[model samples]
Target: MKLLGIDLGSREVKVVVMENQEVSQQFKVSTMSFYRDYCNFTGKIVVDLKKLGVEDADIKISTGYGKNNTDLEEFETINELKAHVYGVFYQTELKNFVLLDVGGQDVKVVRVEKGLITDLELNEKCAASCGRYLENMAEVLEVPLTELAEYSQDPVELNSTCAVFSESELIGQIAEGAKLERLCAGVNYSMYKRLDPLLTKFKGKRLVISGGVAQNKAIRDYLKQDYEEVISLAEPQFNGAIGCCYYGQLTGEAENRE
Candidate 1:
């Protein structure tokens, strides 16, 4: 049976198709493109699965920021927290760990024990610790996002607490002739500082970093200093979508057996 999982995030929409417990296809689209071009928003934003080359999927599951706003018919909607935990469990065999998901708009720090979420900390109101902050900072520095990960060798001290204020501070650093590498490190460290408080609460031995920020090598390195084992999934950003497919298959299989 084929199952489809969709994670409608604030900045991006991730889709994953699974066939018999294995990932068959995956795609990602910017949230703007999705809403502007594909979404039909009379009552709720409905995505045309057929247009995406997905038809007759045995089960469809949705999660993330825009899940409730979607009008996808005959679909199951799951909470973001549940979907994240399931994603980690489905992808990795390790049951006890901490899951850190830094998306465009929010940062989620979750503790998973015995294949379930034990505790969680969510920072949805602030952009300082999220992927959008990094994107903005990279733009100000005139550097590509991918290159920013490698530019930071030694992190400088950045005192700003707000994302907007931090931009001004970074500008001043640029004016003062600070090395680009140090500036990049400082930006990464600044984000880490914002995340530290929430992460401290659910400090576990094993850490699983997911979402867009999971691709940042500097952040992963910083996290490894605190965590005994810091692991990154092959497809960190799509873990939630993958989890949705896994869940769909599990429930669909059970129903079929019944």
Candidate 2:
């Protein structure tokens, strides 16, 4: 059986398909383009699976930022937190760990014990702690995001608490002739600083990071100071969508058993 999962993220839409409980295909599209080209408004925005190019799934599940608010036709909606947790469970097969999912617009830190969620913290109010901050910093530096994520030592000090102001501060550092590596490290470290407070209470030996920021090596390096093990998902960005697919497969199997 084919299971389809769609994660309607703030910046992009992630799509994943699982065939016989294994990932068969995965891709992402800009949210704007996805809504414009692959969806039609029938009083409410309705996703056209044909236009999405994956219409042959036996089951479909939806998650992410728009899951709660967007009413999708011919799809079942799941909470973003639940989907993320399930995705980690499926990918890592670990029952106890701290899950940190930093998205384009927000951050989610969940504490899972014995495969169940015990506590979770969210940082939806600040862009400084999210993936968008790193994107903007990379843009200001005229560097690729991947390159920007490679620096983790001797970071320059960026004191701004706001995401917008931090960009201006980064430009000032450039004018001061700061080393490129230091500037990059500064941006990455600044993000870690913002995340530190949210993570202070969730004490765990292992941390499973998901979402776009999981690819940031510099931030991951900083995170190593707090946890003994910091593991990144193989498909970090597609985790939510993958979780939806896994959830569908699990539920489908249970129904068949019954």
Candidate 3:
């Protein structure tokens, strides 16, 4: 069986296709570009599977921020949280864990037990804790994000109360003769501080992290101090869409038995 999963995020759209339960093709496009170039005159999105070079699939599933905007009736829509849960479980095989996804503009924490979602917490109103914050801080520090990561362990205190004002505060610290390394470290630590509140309420030994920010080793290392293990999927950025495909496969099997 062939399955196509689409995760329509705010900034990007991730596509993953599985042929007979194996990942055959995975690709993505900028969300704005996809809409501008792919949407037709009638306001319908025309995804070009041939352009992605994947054969037609038996099933297609959609999830994430922009899922509801698609006009396709054939696509099955799944909740983002459910997709995250299945994605993490499919990759790690851990039934009980806390999943923390720090995306470009959102933070999601989900508690999973025995393959079921038990409770969840989400932060969308704040941009300070998300990936965008890191990007902005990197720009302020005039350092590559990768280079700035090296300073995470430095003892630097950053104002974490507000996302916008934090930029000015960083500049002020520089004027006060703070080492650039310390300033960079401060940014990384501040990101961690903002995340602490969102994470402290949930207790779990295993932490499965997803989304773009999952690749930050410093952030992951900081989080590791509190968890038994901090794990990330091989395809962290594509976790949600991968989970959508995995869920589609499971649902197909269930239907076949009935």
Query: Which numbered prediction scores highest in lDDT against the true structure?
Result: 2
Worst 10 residues of 3 by lDDT: 38-47
Clashing residue pairs in candidate 2, if any? none
Candidates by TM-score, descending order = 2, 1, 3
Better of 2 and 3 by lDDT: 2
The digit string of per-residue lDDT tens for model 3 on 104-195 reads 78899999888888888899898999888988988888888888777666746776589899998898898899998788778878888889
- lDDT score, candidate 3, position 69: 71
Query: Candidate 1, residues 19-71: lDDT per residue as tens digits?
Result: 97889999999888877777675565677777777778988998888546644
Name the candidate, 1 or 3, with the larger lDDT value.
Answer: 1
**Rank by lDDT (best first):** 2, 1, 3
Which of the two candidates, 2 or 3, achieves a greater TM-score against the reference? 2
Model 2: lDDT to the true structure: 0.92
